[model samples]
Target chain A: MDLVLIQLLNGVQYGLLIFLAASGLTLVFGIMGVINLSHGSFYMLGAYGALTLTQFTGDIFLSLALGVPLAFVFGFIIEWLFIRHLYDRDHLQQVLLTFALILIFNEAQKILWGSYPHSVPVPGYLQGGIKISQFLSYPYYRVAVAAFCVALALAMMFVIQKTRIGRIIRAGESNREMVEALGIDSRLLFRFVFASGAALAATAGIVAAPLESVYPGIGEPVLIISFVVVVIGGIGSIKGAFVGAILIGVADALGKVYFPAFSSSVVYALMAAVLIARPGGLFGRAA
Target chain B: MHNKSRITRRDALKMAGVGAAAAAFPFARPAISQGAPLRVGLLLPYSGTFAALGDGITNAMDLYVKQQGGKLAGRTIEWVKVDDESAPPKATELTSKLVQGEKVDVLIGTVHSGVAMAMAKIAREAGIPTLIPNAGANVLTRAQCAKNIFRTSFGNSQPGVATGIAMIKAGIKTAVTYSWGYAAGEESVAGFKESFVAGGGKIIKELTLPFPNVEFQAGLAEIASLKPQAVYSFYAGGGALKYMQDYAAAGLKSSIQLWGPGFLTDGVEKAAGAAGEGVKTALHYVESLDNAENKKFRADYNAAFKRFPDVYAVQGWDTTQLLDVGLKAVGGDIKKQDDLYKAMRAAKFNSPRGPFRLSAAQNPIHNFYLRELKGGENVYLGVAAADVSDPTTGCNLA
Candidate 1:
């Protein structure tokens, strides 16, 4: 029971981190119709930025404070300069271009930080385990990260469901032409969503840096998982992304623990099962 | 002045001759029969994750060559470089390019087992004197050992076999094996199981995760539940950093004694920081190995690279020495393939790690040290196995 519970918590913690990265990707994909493969680059940039900032500042909060906004600004610049042009382009072109961006980002980082893997220090206050029961205790950092993710998820839901901007984003997702016809300029909306999504991925990167360590190509695995969550959650749907991310997180954690032989293939098997049944994703609309 | 004003046929012919010689210099042949520079092809990753390791090997190899006044085996050295990229699928293509296109006299590679295996196959077929500086898959020395191939590095099993012996000697009654599910991991674990069981230790469980994955909560939870006397793990580089941190984070540091192959704490020991303290590992080379050669190696490497040399660099340093023996014995005539092989097999020398020589399988037979991390570096504990030789069952060089 303790094993299951602790692993369940592990699954949820992993899920929340994935959601932070995938939510932005799903929003960009759903509304903009631009398949931005470079979303993972933003996550990588966030961790790198945070790591550098932390190295200089020696404070986690300060590093994240400077890093998250830096990622946002970087995202905004990228969207304005390059992503805007890619909106009307085909997926193949977008993939090729973004794949090139991945290479560029990796090389640029190597030049900046060298290829050596680096680590971020957890704050002394948040760096211990919390006893949950006689048999079980969990790391405070993980629990704290999970809590922060949950709160962030709620805040995102409230923003997308209640605000005027949320309405614009929703309308943009359902029908971009109609949203434009209704005098809602989606160009600005896309730029906002794209930048915000990049920021979220950065935020996740900052949070995850302590757990995963910062390295070149660190964003790649998370990026792949984010894609899985976004596809599973139904692209562009925050609710679906949340559900899908947690499911994958738990499934992956449990799979690794219980099924050593087939653990690597389990996530893909989940994707296949979802695809066969829905052909889109669990919460994804039919293409 | 009057003579300069006239265009002389002899002067023009002299100038043309010089120009032609200069132009033909790069493509010119005939130095092979003499003691000209031997072309050594280096097939190692220069890009991607393994790039750092590859650079280390290259640096050590260069350092060794420099120490010998830019010559090895009485022949001046010429290096041909190619990036293996640590991709196994591209191994054959890369090796073929080096052996066939570059026409290198000697082939040296590589950091990945899968790629090394492919390079080994090509080197075997071509009868080229091949040196593997660092990958440690057992099959290269066992089933796939070649007459022309030599591994200056330890096999995957050597350290694990040492670890198993260490564990039993330490009186760990029951243990669990946890590792990444890959060839290196599986082979290391297999070696551990062999010695551990032979030493009358009972293994409670064996756990594994896919390669390069860091999420170890579930696996940790299982370890906590089982509460084995000890746990043996095998992971390297960035993955090692996370595992050490997670293992400590889970509060297993105080409870379950964690033992692993030396790579678990090698290059990434600093990154692991406090979490790595007191963790024991078995390996062929440790940074703090006390010897005159190791002292010089560390000091020279620190001066050259501005950092303490790691295991890979040490392995690379030994590779040049291993090759020098062969080349020196054959009088720089690498084309004397049989002679080169025989000389390399019989070559004995004091390495940075200690006394080193090849087993019948052409793999290193040397002391494996039991080391512990203290103050963020590996401190040599003791020798777990001395003059430990490979089983070399399937290899039939005779």
Candidate 2:
């Protein structure tokens, strides 16, 4: 029973972290109608940024504070220079352009950081485990990360469902022409959405950096998993992503413990089952 | 003027005849001259995850050549390099290009075991003399052993067996085994189980997850509940760092002893920080091995590379040393296959890792040291198994 409870927590923590990465991809695909294959690269940039900034600031939180805005600006520039041109193109063209960006970002990371794996230090305060029982103690840093992700999810929900910008964002997602026809600058709104999405993924990377090793190609795995989450949750539904992420995470955790041999295929199996049942996704609109 | 400048059929026929003769003349001479350069193809990863390892091996090999005044066994060396990208699917094509296309007389490679397996199969079929610097797949020197192929690195199971023996000697009778679900992991655990069981130890459980996956929460929780006396695991590079961190973070580090092959702490110790300390492991080489050859190699490597040499560099250096011994015995006549293989198989030299020689299966027979991680370094504790030799299972050498 204790094992099951702990595994559930593990699944939830993992799911929330991945939700941060997948939400950005779904938003870009949903709102801008652009398949940004390089969404994972933004996550990589955040981790590397945290690695560099923490070395200078001597604190992980301070590094997070500085890295998010820098990532926002970087994403804004990337959209203006490359992604904006991709909006009007076909999915194949968008995929090609974004895939090329993935390759470019991977090589650039190698040139800048070399191939050695690095780790960001958890701050002194968040360095130990919180005892749950006689045999179970969860790391304080992991608990803190889970709480932060929950807070971010709530804040995001409030903005997208309750604010003026949120309304315009949803309006653009449903019909870009109608949003533009209402005298709103859809292009500028899109730029903001893409940048904010980039920042969200980066924020995940920064917080998760201390939890795992930061290395070249670290983002590729996260990217692949996030795509699965997006597809399972319906491409543009943040609520769906949340539900999908937690489901996959919990399923993956339990599967690994009980079915060690086929653990790697568990998430894919869940996705296949979901797709077979729903055709679209649990929250995805019919095509 | 245009008609005069254009090539006539007669002129083209004459040029074709000349080209045919030029190509055929080389085949007429059966043997290469003694002083001619020997073509050595280096099929190793120059990009991807193992690039740093590839560079280390290449640099050390080049350093040895430079030390020998840019020649070996009275012949200048010609190097041909192809980046394998550490992708196994591309290995056969790359090996063929090096052997059939470039006609390299010798082959050296590879950091990834999967790529090395493919390269070895091709090199064995082609009957090319191949040296493996880093990959430690046991099959290379066990079930699939070939006369033309030699491995300078230890087998994947050697360190695990050493660790098992060390743990039994330390009086730990109950333990669990954990590793990535791959051939290397399985083989290492098999080795550990063999030794541990022989020494009257009982295994509590065997846990595994997918290769290269760092999510260890579920696995760690299980370990905490089961409460084994010790845990033996196999991981390297980034995965190793994360495993150590997770183990320490779960509060199991104080109650359960963690053991693994030395790769558990080898290259990622600094990044692992406090989580890596006090972990015991067994390996064929440590930076602090106290020996005359090791001391000299360390000084020379530091002087040349401007950084401290790791186990990969030591393996690379030994590879060249073995090659030098073979070439000197054959007087640089690479075509003397019988004599060259005999000399290479009989090679005995003092390596930086200690006295090195080949087992009957042509894998390295050397000491496995028991070491503990202290302050981001593998502090040598003692010899876990001296001059350990692999069992050479299923190797007929036919």
Candidate 3:
């Protein structure tokens, strides 16, 4: 029973981290109507950025403070330079362009960092675990990450659902022309949304550095998993990403525990089942 | 008397000419003169995941050639590098290009076992003398053994068997094995099981996760529930780092002893840091091994590369030594395939690790050291198995 409970917590924790990454991807797709294949590269860049900043700053928080904004600016610049030209283009063009960005980002990272794996040190306060039962204890840092991500998700949900910008984003998602007709420059909003999405991925990267090894191609796995989450959650829905992430995470965790041999395929199997049952996603709107 | 001496000299010259003709005609080479530079094809990864290892190994190889005054066996070596990229699907195609296209005199590679297998098959059929410095797929020396193929590294089972023997002797009766589901991982566990079961130890369970997956918490939870006395795992690179960190984080570090192939702790020690403490592993080489050769190697390597040499570097360095032995034996005449193979087969010399020799199967017979991670470094504990050679079970080299 305790094992079940601890693994559940683990599942939720992992789900929340994936959601942090996928939320940006979903938002960019939904709000900007741009398929950003290099979304995961933002996550990779975030970790690499944190690794570099942490060395100079000697504090995780300071590194994050600088790293996230740097990612935001980098994303903003990428939008103005390359992605802006693709907004009116077809999905095939968007995919090819974004895919090119992934290669560029991967190669650039290799040039900057070399191909060795690097680790981010967990700070002093988050070192120990919180004991849940006599035999089970989960890492305090992981729980902290889960809690923090949940809060961030809630904050994002509040902004998307309540604020004027939220209404514009919603309107833009439903009909970009109508939103632009209302005197709001959809282009500027898109730039903001794209950059903000990149920041979210960067934040996920920073928090996850200590848990996972930071290296070349680290983004690829997360990118693939996040795509699964996005598809299952319904591409543009923040709630869908959250629910989908948690479901996938918990299912993956339980799957490994019960079915060790087939654990690797469990998440994909979940996606297949969800696709068959829902046709869209759990929270995704019918196209 | 002068005329008789001239006649004898002429006779001796005639005999020498006849002998030279006999030797050179069959060998397909005139002499080991300063001919065209020897084309040494390097089928190693230059990019992707194994790039750093490839770079280290490449540097070590260059160091050896440099040490030999820019030549091996009096022939200047010219390197034709093709990035193996550590991709198995491309291994055969890439290897064929190196052999068929470049027409390299010798072939040296590679880090991944899958890639090595492909390269081995092609090299064997083509009769290209190839030295594998790192890949340890056991089958290369055993079932897939070839007369021209040689391995400087240990078979995947050597360290596994060594660790198993050590563990059973140390009274680790019940253990659980965890590994990525792949050939290398399976081979590692099988090797351990062979010696462990024979030595009267019980493996309570064997758990395998998918290849390239880092999520190990569920497995750890199962391990905690089972409460095995010890755990043996086979994972390398980033996954190894994460596994070690998770093993410690899961709080099983103090309870169940952690053991693995040395790769689990060797390269990732610095990144793993405190979490990797107290983990025991077995391998053919350790960084802190105490020996004159190791000392000199470490010193020279540090001077050349500006960093400490790891196991891959040692394997790369030894590959050149292996090449040198063969080349010198045949006086740089690589075309004399039989003589070259004989020279390589007969070489027994001290290496940076220790004294090692090629077995009848052309695999290294070297000592395996049991090592413990103390203070973030692999401190050599003891020699687990001395002069261990792969049994080469299914090989029929004869």
Candidate 4:
């Protein structure tokens, strides 16, 4: 019973982290009608950025505080320079450009940091474990990260559901032309959304940095899994992404424990099961 | 003035003609006969995750050459490099480019086992002198063993075999074996099981995840529930660092002992920091080996490279040392293939990893040291297994 509980917590923690990444991807793909393959690079950038910032500032939280804004600016520049031109192009072109961006970012990371793996220290206060049983105790840092993710998720929900910007975003998602006809520039809106998505992904990276240890190609796995999460959650539905991310996290964690041999494929198996039942994803609009 | 100018022009033309003839004379003779630079093809990952390992190997090999007055066995070394990208699919093409295209006399490689396997197949078929510096695929020196191929590094199972012996001696009677489900990992576990089971120890369980995956939460939770006496694992680079951190974080570090081959804490010691404390590992080389050769090598390498050398660098240094022995025996005539192979097979020299030589399978037979992580360094505890030779399983070196 204790084992199951701990595994569930592990799955939930992992799922929350994945949701942070997947939520950004779902937003960009659902609202902008853009296939952004380089979304994971933002996560990589955040982690690397955290590594550098923490080195200089000597604080992980401060690094996150600074990193999110910088990532937003970086994303704003990227959308303006490249993604803006890609808006009218086909998915193939978007994939090509973003794929190229992945390669470019990977190379840039290599040039700047080399190929050595690096670690950021967890702050001293959140260092030890919170005892649950005689043998099993959860790390305080992990619990803190989960709490932060919950808070962030709630804030995101509040902004998307209750605010004027959220109304504009929902309206833009449904009908961009109508939103533009209402005298609001949809282009500026999209750029903000894209930048916000980048910031969210970066936030995940900064928090995950101490745990995962920053390394080359770190973004690639997260990117692939986030895409899965987005697809499973219904490309444009934040609620769907949340449920899907949790499903994958729990399924993946439990699978590793129970079906050790087939653990790697368990997530894909879950996706297949989901797709078989709902072709449009759990919350996707009927096409 | 006209006469003097004409004479000077004629003299300059004469000198140019002589210089051109002197350069052309070497090309006129048959290549590889004598007095030509020995072309060594470096088929290693110059990019990607293994780039640092490649750089370390290349630097140490060059340092060795430099230490030998920039020549080995009376032949100047000429390096032909091709970045394998740590991709096995491209290994054949890259190896062909080095072997047939550049016509390199010696081939040295490689960090990834898959890439090394492909390189080994090509080298065996082509009958080229190949020295593997880092990759530890057991098949290289086992079923696929060849006279032309030699490994300065351990087989995939060698260090684990040593670790198993150390664990049994340390009174760990029940343990769990954990690793990524790959050839290297499976072989490592098998090696550990061999000695551990032989020493009257029982393996409680074996757990594995897919290769290169850093998710260890579920695995750690299971480990805590099982509550084994110790946990043996095989992981390297970033994955190793994360595993150590996770193992410590999961609160299992205080209860269950963690052990593995030296790679667990080898390169990522500083990054692993406090999480890596008291973890025991068995490896052929530790940074603090407490030998004169290792002491001098460390000092010299730090002087040259501005960093302490790791196991990969030691393997790189030993690759050159083995090459030197073979070349010296054949008097630098690489065309003397049979004699060169014989000399290399008989090679015995003091290496940074301690006394190194080839087993009949042509893999390194050396001491595996049991080291503990203390203060961000692999402190040498003692020799876990001395002059250990890998069992030449399925080898038929005809």
Which prediction has the highest TM-score against the true structure?
1
Ten contiguous residues minimizing lDDT sum, candidate 2 chain B: B1-10
Candidates, ranked, lDDT: 4, 2, 3, 1
Per-residue CA lDDT of candidate 4, range B1-398, in tens? 23323433553475476467657785664455577778899998765556667767877897899899879999977677788987889999999999999889999998888899999999999999999998989999999999999999989899989999999999999999889897788988999999999999999999998977899988888888888999999988778888999999988889999999998987788888999999999999999877899999999888776667889889999999999999999999998999999999999989988889899989989999999998989998999999898889888863
After superposition, which runs of candidate 4 have C-alpha atoms over 4 Å from their true positions? B1-39, B46-51, B69-71, B74-104, B329-335
Q: What lDDT does the true structure give each of the candidates? A: 0.85, 0.86, 0.86, 0.89
List fnat per candidate, in order: 0.40, 0.52, 0.35, 0.59
Best model per DockQ = 4
Query: Mind giving the per-residue lDDT tens digits that candidate 1 earns over A20-66?
Result: 99999999888888888888988888887878788788877787788
DockQ values for all predictions?
0.29, 0.30, 0.21, 0.32
Could you tell me every candidate's TM-score relative to the true structure?
Answer: 0.92, 0.91, 0.91, 0.91
Off by over 4 Å in 2: B1-40, B45-51, B74-87, B97-104, B331-335
- Interface Cα RMSD in Å, per prediction: 13.3, 13.2, 15.7, 12.8
Error of 3 at A279 (Å): 2.5
Q: Candidate 4: which docking quality band?
A: acceptable
lDDT of 3 at B154: 81
- Which residue pairs in model 1 clash with each other? A233-A240, A234-A284
Winning candidate number (lDDT): 4
Rank the models by DockQ, top first. Answer: 4, 2, 1, 3
